[model samples]
Target: MNKVKVLTVVLFIIAFIEVIAEYFRIIPLIYVFKPLISIVLMLLYWLSSTKKETLFFLTITTSLITNVLFIPNDLKFIFVGLIIFVFHRLINIYYILKVMKTKDFIPVVLASVPFLIVFFYIFFDTDLLTKEVYYIMIIHNSLISLLGGIALSHYIMNDSSRSSWLLICVLSFVTLHFIIFIEKFYIELQIFRPIAMSLNAFAYYAFYRFILIIERSNSN
Candidate 1:
């Protein structure tokens, strides 16, 4: 009916087609649909709200760039795209810090440290990525840990539905990225690829919801 609802239906429909295409190994139209997810997601959020908050707009735009660049399946594009994503996370972390000033720093560090250690150890041990990309990964993942950790800390501190949804947004990205990492660097898994695509779409939706929650909070 409305723009957001229309895009909501359209987004999941695209996601469904992608999952089916990936699972069934349907090559036709796969590439076209693959990149449409981000475009529609960007539009969904852009049309829904937010022009006053400049940082949020920048985050959405950078996210678009990162997703589009990464879709090419080229190492150079992926590397550059990942670098841009680091900025995306940084913007996110900065935004979270502005709102979350609770005395939960210790908890955030505790929650993120173990995962960071494991991430560094496993990825560094492997020679899968080039030195540059590995360095970028280190920075990118550290920012991710901080972002996710901050979201987790905020959720724990407030125990509100908004914070819970925020955590879900973070988790979607973490989960999908892990699957992509395993699929890319480790072994080529078939089923998980489609699952990841579906989850990626959900991730965007969760993030859109999280943004809307924040928007409401800001206005109120």
Candidate 2:
């Protein structure tokens, strides 16, 4: 596990260098470098039996790459954020249904509104996407989020109870704050990006630990 963590750190360093190099015009690496490094890191983790960790890293890396590569306006960023939020909602929905709990529809409806708006805007304003294709992105992202979230939650968790949910909420909040902090400040991207990544990794680990604890409790 320590070796896997070390490799993840190294890959993160390589990704940072690539992203910075492109940002400063030092070298023209493809924007795909970010996702490529992410895929490499994820593959390493998967080989090491850390599939949930791999998925978390891959999802965040893809989201960041999409944002950077698309060069969307502020409104569009908000639009994308809403899309991501809906993805989370979809995951939360699956979990709720799995546990036979009622889902709060307000959250689901609220999350979808922005993305729905973006869908129309893309169709009417840009030739890049036909109406059908725009909905495809929405469906595609939501499905990714749903599968990623459910698989991640289930893999990291070992119990059929609610205790792990607390860890999930905590970890999600940490990621949210990390993203917001980076956006709000002019800090060194390379320095803080890995720290954020590490937090996410640890949070997932903690979430798994919570699951184990709950499993033990239930068994006893």
Candidate 3:
């Protein structure tokens, strides 16, 4: 088999192991393997694709950093890690802006406003996080919503074959974040946490594939 196929196998194996470790409450194993998911997937992408887009690379790298930092299980560390993820989202926005053709900015602004208001309101009312962390959460949610809206706008404005895949990728990202919010704040069901984490990892892989599909469509 080729290198890409080999790497794909490795990535899946790693993901499976992570899920098992998390489900079994093997804290030591989970700590070791969970962070490697992003790193291995990033390597797979780097090896498989000839075109190395800077924004995509940065997104994956920051994601790796976020995953690694999150393994510590400290609120402060996780907060900092999420700050890095915000940078990841900002880079993604820059990339989306570059590829998207529609210049109608009003729709993007209007789409983001409702989500921004809702998130701010929810965070303002919540006692789950400190004031500083609450502000960070608001900023993070706002950027994620803005990114989703921008991606949706691109799909709406474009007539390309890749639009659907692009939309799926954006939706996957949004879903992953929503699950994260639930896992952190809304739920304490330990049995389901592994499932949520696995789903999050799968979403990242799906996002990578959709990006590759879009790039291929552009090339064709």
Candidate 4:
């Protein structure tokens, strides 16, 4: 078989094995492998696709927001952040609905507002802000993950490249992060922690393979 096909088979095998291992509790690997798996999928997409370009700016922005949100906060900040995330989601849905015939770019601009609010609040309002060198690491890691998702969604959507890519990337990170964060917080709840992490990783790997298929199809 060809390289892409080999890769596809390999991912499926990995997923199958992971599920089996999880069922029997034979493996001791960290359960948080899902996000990393998602990142792997994204990297595969970027490497396989010949026509795509990296959305660096958007990745940076999303990463910064993630770091900011990681800051400790009371209910007040949580409420504000939730509101911002909701606004971002609403704008994203509106843009998705009109993505096909709408080339105006207004929707793209509108969609960015909520994200901007998120980043702004994290950067300016959070007391946990540290301008130390490590913040760069946080930014870098976040961007890589976000960019990976963006690349995957880009390959999946296959159209309306600008908006769908952004929306998916943001939403995926938010969804996965929240789930993982909650799971970590409840370490005693053995059912939710590692299992969710493994599933997240599997989901990410599946997505990565799917995008690889899409990239191969486009190349042909």
Candidate 5:
């Protein structure tokens, strides 16, 4: 517990440092703190969760890789990162499937509509998305939408702190990607970069909390 508590604090500090680095354009700090985040969160999960979820750890690994790919700020690298992120979302969805009580298709579809709209509007906006990237976005955004929809469905059906955390965790990912889209594709919103990092940190914490809650819920 002490370890978990300390790591959680460390996570916050890391987020603060990374965001400040991003905002100030501190290259060294950005390089150092950015990668440290998932490492720390993976440790927190290892210490906190009673049942070690290999799937979750895999998610962390892929997320770390994806984040690293995104650090270059190159569109090509980011496109590859999106490919990896599709896998990350797949792992999350699979994990959620194992834990969630039921699957409601209607809720999933209804919940995903907004995200799909945003994705399509952006990808189809200009000459940015070529034939290949357009197809990739279709597959990628579909999975992302499915991931968010499932999380939202879980939250709606189960009114509890666990579900709430789950929803927050997923939305943090969604929002971070939304900003990434805006910054990378639409326009350069410099502020959104730090905001995305902060959301990433909070998402890690929320995911940790959600796991604990769901594990306890299952045990009960």
Candidate 6:
């Protein structure tokens, strides 16, 4: 691979090390590497593409901000992070719609309904968040479900040989968010925390790969 791809691999290595260090309670290493994870992914995304460059840049930058804000465990910080994440989701929606197949529209919309019901149940029953924050969380969760549905639909409709990469990227995103929900409310077990962080890094790497694959297809 090229320089950007090499850099992407290096970033993933750094992220994996950071997560492992956190799991082992290596505080000094965690403090040094935790904040850099998103920055490295942002740069990786920025360096990896020419097509849809603006949208990809904005998406990763907003995600970086959201991740940074999430480092604080306060409700206020989480609320702000949710807002930023919502913006990022909106951008993702726009990008997905741009390449969406007409035939996939109804399928995508239908697929989102079940996810919406599940998230509504989770958010509505939770006593962890205040009323305002609860509503924000519901909205954020809904957007994530919608984005996943769109990505899934796109992957299904895409006929290209490498379309499976798109599906993998979407799955990584869904997994990352699902782990975030568990980490936020239920339990942050020792085993799961590192897995969550690994998922987060994988989500970014997979998205970068998805973009590269799409760019190559378009060029051909």
Winning candidate number (TM-score): 5
- Per-candidate TM-score against the hidden true structure: 0.85, 0.37, 0.84, 0.38, 0.92, 0.86
Clashes by residue pair, model 6: none
After aligning candidate 3 to the native by TM-score, how far in Å is the CA of 124 from where it should be?
3.6
Least well predicted 10-residue stretch by lDDT in candidate 4: 55-64
Cα lDDT tens digits, model 5, 1-220, are 8888888889888989999998887888888998899889888888988888898789788988888888877778977987887888788778877777555578888888888888777767857776656777788778877778877887777778988988999899888877877776678867988998898888877887888788887888
Cα lDDT of model 1 by residue, 11-109, tens digit: 899889988887876766566776777778777877887643666667767877776676557898998898888888888777666654445588888
In angstroms, give how far residue 95 of model 4 lies from its true place: 21
Error of 3 at 186 (Å): 3.0
lDDT tens per residue, model 4, 174-215 = 545445444433233445434543554443444333333444
Q: What TM-score does prediction 5 earn?
A: 0.92
Give all candidates' CA lDDT scores: 0.76, 0.46, 0.74, 0.42, 0.82, 0.73
Name the runs in model 2 displaced over 4 angstroms: 1-9, 18-30, 50-74, 88-220
- The predictions' CA RMSDs to the true structure, in order, are 2.6, 9.6, 2.5, 10.7, 1.7, 2.5
What is model 6's C-alpha RMSD? Answer: 2.5
Worst 10 residues of 1 by lDDT: 95-104
Give the winner by lDDT: 2 or 4: 2
Error of 5 at 150 (Å): 1.4
Look at candidate 6 and tell me the lDDT of residue 91.
90
TM-score of 4: 0.38
lDDT of 2 by residue, 1-220 (tens): 7876687677666666654644454424534554455456555545454224333443445454543543332555655665664555454445434432324444444444544454334335544544534664456444433433443444344344444554364446435443533443334454444444444444434433443344445456
Steric clashes per prediction: 0, 0, 0, 1, 0, 0
